[model samples]
Target chain A: MGRKQVWEQGEVLASAMRLFRRRGYLGASLRDLEEATGMHPGSLYRAFSSKEGLFSAALDDYNERVVEGRVRAHLRDAEDPVAGIRSFFTSAFDTGGGPEPDPGCLLTNTAVESFSVPHVAPGVRRGLETIESGFADALTRAQAQRLLPEELDVEKSAAQLLALYQGLLVLVRSGTDAAKLHTITDGALALIRARNATAKQADEEEQR
Target chain B: MGRKQVWEQGEVLASAMRLFRRRGYLGASLRDLEEATGMHPGSLYRAFSSKEGLFSAALDDYNERVVEGRVRAHLRDAEDPVAGIRSFFTSAFDTGGGPEPDPGCLLTNTAVESFSVPHVAPGVRRGLETIESGFADALTRAQAQRLLPEELDVEKSAAQLLALYQGLLVLVRSGTDAAKLHTITDGALALIRARNATAKQADEEEQR
Candidate 1:
């Protein structure tokens, strides 16, 4: 493809991503897609094949740009991995006091909206697993640095955090109060820290 | 209305609930509703007013029957409130080894699928709050009975549990392994228990 064609495709996917994120998979009609993407039906079909194809491509774009981007910023690169995970959760509900309520994570919305949609299921699973594994890696590092307890089950805690992450998104989408969500997030992190302290104390008692 | 009319309304709502649970608010078309409820479009609109009206009614019916029924069975009536809450989470993924995957909680799905939907938002909020308050009530009882630590923050813990519950349903809907979900649930419950134990031990140490 020429440079202009590549730029146009990129623009189209970005527009499609916004529409899908806002409206969800089933909610975004073809006409809505056309309006969002500024493409005629014939051109859309010629370019992306079908609505499902377009949606699938959009999901991929979301995973790469949004999902992986957060992982890189908050988990992989942040100085404090555990705090990074908390920051990741914070970002979900930090709508910047915008008039529009948070649209929520695209991967999470897709997971809830298109669980049985075959074309989109793989991308949904992949995106979700990315976050789960990111948590696991971060918790593992935290434990290694003695930030978390040695007895902490990194894998299980990671999975639990993943659930908490998804749950917060669901609540945010439902227009839950940000303050309440922040309390819940704090409670979860405190549980982890409290558990670590308890474990460390227990180890000290055993040594005595 | 006649007795037959009342019975038919119940039946139609039941069918509509199942379809909405399966397809979500936006995914369920009028044709799907017709096929699910065995009603023509004219009859459906006449009875429920509009597609949104039918969905709203279906959500109300779900809240009354499924949400409240579970609270009655697992939280209100169960002998052990914390265990009851556990059972409630268990029921979300318990498909009895059926060929079909679990459809997930209707309120959680709606919260994800139709957050901005004006007509359906209230029902979604009511249904979700019902579960959150159920957890709160159950936790309060558990703390009163000394099954939990006195220092436990009932409200925060309840909100966290609510998030975990919704998160588990989202994962289940996305076809996460049942065993993994069970592990996550177990981890969450164990954290509560462990925290309680730690708090109790600290109190004992203080007395010494």
Candidate 2:
């Protein structure tokens, strides 16, 4: 055998992530992976073992780079926890005015595509949990600050927010225009605010 | 060539829809389609042209039967429009208490799987539009009857409801328990009711 060639794992993973997102897990072919990563079939196997192995690594990369990084930045940099939640919804549409070639979340995509490949389903589940927990933490903070309805079930609300977020991503991927998505996200924020407003009204009524 | 065999298009579409729902568009194979529909490869080709062709037919069937049928029934059978909207959401989780082998919406599945296959994306869009319009009609009626907030933008609220409903479906498909899905759905309905309650409090305050 010739001298074993070494490759940058991150570079391979980045390319794999893009390929998997664009073509999906089952739709992506070995030739597509080879071309995207500039690795021959033998090198691809030597480095990643199998397509599924490569997919798992790519999913990890997506979780860290896309989901985790975005969640932390949005939550940390916001004016407050409520604003942070609103910011989270708005930022999904800030993809710069360029035409979006691929617009869906890879984790959401994997959730739909994970039926056949059961091993990857757990990764999607974890990605979903990360999002749910992020929303849960924010909602909890909002409640403590009296910015959210005291009666809000943080766990259930967080799960609902996660689902709405995932659904918005699905609509975005399904070719809904940015303007319409912005309206939907705005409506969501209004609903959240209305919950708090209604609680305040109830308090005022009791005092009266 | 032997005489073309007559095949029931409805049966083929139903079988293809099930296979596509269980295994995603990309994950479902020609062999799986053949096995599900009980048709040989040549007959399958003769009937539907190609895999994409069959997927298109299956998508049409899903739109007609699952999506439109459910929306119409929920809206018509309810006591009123607002009740119709609530009914629309409540009906999604009524799976008769059996083990839910498939817990997600087929159109939502197609939406995620529509990235590479641009042709099928329109069908997902139509499904979403039908849902949004259904919610909008109900909300409009609710506003006229003073059951919803006057300032509510029916269009945006409808889209938001669509996203929430779609999100709920995604959660269901992701192995969330049926009871949990029910709670999440209940939370959504409460949010909708709270919108009007807050408005009622504001009116009472004005009167006071």
Candidate 3:
């Protein structure tokens, strides 16, 4: 076997993340990790010293490269920044694959479970901030190009989007049907677009 | 203990709920419950039987009392249904104590951590459904009073409110300060009101 096949660090972390997403920190055990990742306990520990350590590393990797990437990748390929934002919400909230929605963003799951738990809180906070920054960055670029209105509060709006994303995750987890998510995400993005248009009109009127 | 105190079988459940709120189910333990509630393991088992049973009871109580009561209480007192919703979102997102806001809403935390877990999913669903029904009931009442336009979709709007509320909880958990939440909440409510006004105006215009 090739060295890459022997050392499946990314693959192992992904499996652990799925478990963490389903069962939280205390909910998940080392044995669960072993079962999910197909690694012996010794092999898992050699890769990640403790369960907490493994979770943290998985979160960092997922946030930077996977979850944030999902949003960033959407923004990168879209011709219209507005369309990008719109599509981002759709993909994030709309449960496409099944009758019942899957659990929401794993990062969100970790954040909710990490509140007073010190071992996991920092990692969760860091991942969320990174995701927030990514949204703000995209928004900033969109505004500079005159796609988004001048008076739009990107930071607050970004915060709102993050909240919106988190809330949708809760909805999906609670077994809210895909149709419910579709409407909610639609209403949110509609408000976003309408508000920007209204702000721009107000600015133009002020200039006149 | 006073005679009234003798009937407080639910106090231990309250303590357990607080612990579950502060720390997730897997994070909170029988030992933790013993320390927090000052009940011996035998007394606790006599009262609740198992950790899962205690959680089930505590969650049921919270949904019926705290989460549902908060929303129904808002609707009960407001002059306008929209105003009532604004107040509901404000209070639901606010954690009562904490120097920096420790991610409020027990229902939300439970939704995130327990929805996919085998035992707690039903309770979490019940909590969300109760909250959603709060909005639906309020909107339906308003429609009966001719406050919302006839063409307005009450079921859809309630679903949106549910989505928004859940999303806001995620926002609260993700460390959104009140100021940020207020901004988003205001934007959302204003849009709802503006849309209603627009639809009414369109009806008047069409009649002319």
Candidate 4:
């Protein structure tokens, strides 16, 4: 790829990500890509090879640019690993509140869309794995610091957190008025906080 | 629609539901629909109006036949309401273990797919509402029967359960053998079980 070609590829991938996120992998057509990227069908095919190829690139872009970046920030920035887990959620799913056009998570959307499009499913699954491991790593760090209860299952908690995160995205897609997600997030946080309390109680017991 | 046409419509909707669940709304094309339902494009269009029309009907069929039926069974059959909630998860997601094709939930798939297809989003949202409210109602009943913690936030717990349910579906779709989903379910059940223990303690305190 030449400099201009590489730059154009980046632009096309970025645009395709937005399009796929808004309109699912199968929903968006080649014409739609042409319109979004200002490239004719012939050029788009030559560049990305196929619609599946373009969608795969877009999903990779999503993983690298959006999901991985967030994971890096949340995992690296926070001194407290558990707090980093909490922040990962509040930021990924902040939604900014109220009824809005919440598309939920792009990777999650692809995960669901993957069932239909086998060619692109692997990329979507990899994206989910990246997130699951990222969360599990932070949780392991929390365990190392004894921030979580000794008996607390880090892997399980990580999965619980993953479910809560994706589930909330599913709920938010509806644009409901009730504070449904608020309670869900608080409940999850409470579970983590409860572990913290248990750890503290254990520490006090040991001190005595 | 004639009696024969109505029967055919039911069969087509049933087949379409499976296709949509597997292929998603946009991923499966008209030809795919015909292949699934054994109907020609002209017949399919005449019967269902359009591809979107067939998809909408399939979603409704899924809502009525699959989701609502499970909600009814779990809510009505189990006397212990919390256990009913537990059984609901186990039955709805019993993939029968090992490497199998677990499509997760059709409603959840549509919920993810709903971000793009405007016509089908409402039905998907309604299906979620049905589950959330069903869980909430069961919790409410559990509280009235003193089966759960009196102070337990039924709505919040319901929302948390919602997140857990959808999130597990997302995880299972990836075919990861991390035992991630197991912990999520156990952790969620523990939260409810903790409430039960709390209720028992409260009862003891009252007697004392």
Candidate 5:
């Protein structure tokens, strides 16, 4: 593709991703996609083959840009990996103060919407596994830093964090208050903190 | 309505509930509802006014029958409320060894699907709130029984459990393995267990 065509294609995929995240798979009609992407039906089908193909592309874009970006920012690059995980959870909610309700994570929305579009199941699973693995990596680092107890099952806790992440997204999409979600996030992180040897040492030092 | 008519209506709602749970809001078309309920479109409209109306009623049925039933079975009536909460989480998965994939909880499904069907938002919130409150009630009882530390925040922990519950359902629908889900559930309950004075005391007694 030419340079302009490549840029346009990226823009179209981004638009499609927003629509899918907001309306879900079945909820976003072909006509809706056309409108959102500013592309004609003939051009859309010619480009992406079918609505499912377009959706899969959009989901791929989401996993690469959104999911991976968050993982890198909060888990891999952050100084404190556990703190990064907490930031990762809190980051799902929009802090922009926009009037639009939170549309939730595209991976989570697709996972729930996969009941209708089973073809997207593998993509949804891939995105979720990415987050799960990110958590595992972060927890392992946290354990090495004495931020977590040595006995903590990093794999299982990572899986739990994945579930908790998805669950918070569900609440966000369901119009849960941000304050409430914050409290839940804090409580969840505290569960991890309670298992932190460093945190226990700090407590002991303070008592002394 | 006559007794027979009432019985038939209950049956139809159950069928509709299952269809919605399986297919989500927009995924379950009018024809699908007709086939599921064995009611013609005109009759369905006459009975429930519109698809949205029918969906509202079905959600109400779910909250009453499925949500409330689970709460009573695993939370209210169980001898140990903490164990009851654990059972409530596990109960979301199908243990029957059926070939059919888990349909997940209707409440979580509807919450995710509510982006398209905003009318069902209240019912979804109500169902989630019921579970959160159920968790709170159980935690309070556990604390009263000295099963939990007096300093544990019941409300915040309940909300965290609510998020965890919804997240697990998302994973379940997304086709995560049951064994993985069980481990996540156990880890979550252990967080609560870590806050259990009774459990700690029992550990101490055993060690002694």
Candidate 6:
């Protein structure tokens, strides 16, 4: 209602997201939300239609502020697809490498918590699928330009990249050394690179 | 606590594990715990101590029964380390894969929750780390036996495996297709195998 109330509402949602990311939808509560956001039940309810509503806002914030802006940008920023993927992963590891790491990605977190309740599961589902599609589309374009392997299944390859990102984030959050993550990603990206190069050789030979 | 109450404790904890695994700690409530486990707060507390106490027990149950007993057994039952890792991944996917999936690993879910709250954080940390260590150790030994490969860092390699498992389970819970999960796992595992073989071959040739 008041200006402070609006700011508090945003603050409440942020706290809720952090708590939700830390615990999950079923694990968090109105009380926890209140404590974190500094809002009482009536105020919390007035701002958020329900607990689920708060969670939905938190997830939206996570995707918009972090996943699209950070993760995807990290992937696409390199001069090429291969370099882009590598940069994305390096950032993924280093970003979480500090003493404090936000558990890899909140999007990955959403994939886990959206199932047991009728809350914002769809939003999370779409978020996961949407990112995978973006990467897949990139890979497809790369393949057409001979940047990726012809053998790469557009959707499956996308999922593999998505899986790698998701899995690597978990490791980072779990406090793995950056060197180890580098090795893991190096090995993975190498495989993708090899596949791409091999496909190119075959295509060149066929054209000749 | 009465004998009947003590007897019900295990069931209550079991219910908690299933619910916690499915919904995570913050998402599920005392009322949800009561409804799921069919116990009153007084009785539940009398048996387990508190909500955090109950969670601690549930995590233990997950280790002893779900992970150690079931997952480990399946891994060992496989013909080789490659298959063993596959078994572990498949099991993670099995629980997570379906038309509707449960998105959380009980241990990963605990880690997410415990990070924000210091209350039961220690136990949560210990349990999840134990599982990660278990998978890595098993994979390392498999590599030592030449079932995995020489280039793979046992710790790093194992983290990769665990990361993929956690990632896929999260996606599955987020409404990822069961079939696509199969693709992600297959692609990931193949690269792991390829890395191992290529590194081993190079090392073997160097020995010659």
DockQ of each: 0.38, 0.39, 0.37, 0.37, 0.38, 0.28
- Model 2 captures what fraction of native contacts? 0.53
Clashing pairs in 1: none
**Residue by residue across A79-99, what tens digits does model 2's lDDT show?**
477778766876776676768
How well does chain A score by TM in each candidate? 0.86, 0.85, 0.80, 0.81, 0.87, 0.75
**How close is chain B to the truth by TM-score, in each candidate?**
0.87, 0.84, 0.80, 0.83, 0.87, 0.77
**Which docking category, incorrect, acceptable, medium or high, applies to candidate 1?**
acceptable
Candidate 6 runs further than 4 Å off: A1-51, A96-104, A115-117, A141-148, A177-179, A190-208, B1-9, B95-104, B116-149, B196-208
Looking at model 4, the pairs that clash are none
Instruction: Give the clashing residue pairs of candidate 2, or none.
Output: none
Model 6 Cα lDDT, one tens digit per residue, A91-164: 76665446655644667666655555566777776677667776765676677679765876566667777777
Give candidate 2's iRMS in Å, 1 decimal: 6.5
Global CA lDDT computed for model 5: 0.79
Expressed as tens digits, the lDDT of each residue in B44-80 for candidate 2 is 8877888888898888888888888877776534457
> In model 5, where do residues sit more than 4 Å from their true spots?
A1-7, A194-208, B1-7, B194-208
Candidate 5, B86-205: lDDT as tens digits? 778877885678786676678888888787788888899999999988888888998888977787777777888898889988998888998887766764575564443232332332
**What tens-digit string does per-residue lDDT give for candidate 4 at A1-208?**
6645533677878887788887777778888888888888877788778888888888889899888888888864557887687667656556567574554677777777766667876777777767777877887787789876567655556666777788777766656443555556565555554432233432442231
- Top candidate on DockQ is 2
Residue A56, candidate 2: how far off, in angstroms? 1.1
**Positional deviation of B171 in candidate 4, in angstroms?**
2.0
1 against 6, candidate with superior DockQ: 1
Q: Candidate 4, after superposition: displacement of residue A95 in Å?
A: 4.7
The lDDT values for all models are 0.77, 0.74, 0.68, 0.70, 0.79, 0.64
| Higher-ranked by DockQ: 4 or 5 | 5
| lDDT score at residue A73, model 1, on the 0-100 scale | 91
Q: TM per model?
A: 0.89, 0.87, 0.81, 0.82, 0.90, 0.75
Find the candidate with the highest lDDT and give its number.
5
